[model samples]
Target: MSDAYLVRYVGGPLDGRVDTLPGLPDEPRETVTHVHLHGGPKIVHHYDLHYALEYGCEYRLREAEERDLAQD
Candidate 1:
């Protein structure tokens, strides 16, 4: 099964944007991905693993504890 990740924007114009995304490919790849905005659903053009890495964003596996804590 594919893993889920919490993607957080740490810097740049998109800073503070956080969303749950499906785990990327095992190997680094350059491809587009989608992100949901707080106001509404919008497409992020040309989003990819490399782009995320270059922009100071972070991706962490979605752990049970974190998910539970967030709901508390």
Candidate 2:
């Protein structure tokens, strides 16, 4: 079994909330499987944090639907 925390990577599916990430405009909806890490402390009000992993990435824009909200 993969030791990676698979559960945390799975979110925003079925509810159509996944449609909200940026750069997904007109793109067929697809699920992303990955992992991230938080450091120092956790903030409830904060969304995803930019943690540097040896082999990982972070988003440059608000996730899809969240971005849509900013458009207004």
Candidate 3:
């Protein structure tokens, strides 16, 4: 299963806010690095990858089991 992640802003005008992206990839890091090299945000906060599939199985099982139990 493909994993999902949430990218949150740490500090700045957009701080404490999460960026809802179509897809989170390493592309942002590459861009940030390039900008930094050319004089940009010195303390760039990289996107944090919060694994969405960590407890995915448990959630699926819970839903399936609930349905099965209701039929019983």
TM-scores for the candidates: 0.30, 0.19, 0.30
Model 3, runs deviating above 4 Å: 1-3, 30-72
Candidate 1: tens digits of C-alpha lDDT, residues 1-72: 855655564333455777666765355443323455677667343333334553233533333464456447
Separate clash counts for every candidate? 0, 4, 0
Residue 1 error for model 1, in Å?
7.7
lDDT of each: 0.47, 0.31, 0.35
Compose the digit string of candidate 3's lDDT tens values, residues 2-65.
5544555443334465444445454443211101333564532233322343222111112345
31 in model 2: Cα distance from truth in Å?
Answer: 20
Could you say which candidate leads in lDDT?
1
Off by over 4 Å in 1: 1-3, 28-72
Candidate 1's error at 21, in angstroms? 1.4
lDDT: which is higher, 1 or 3?
A: 1
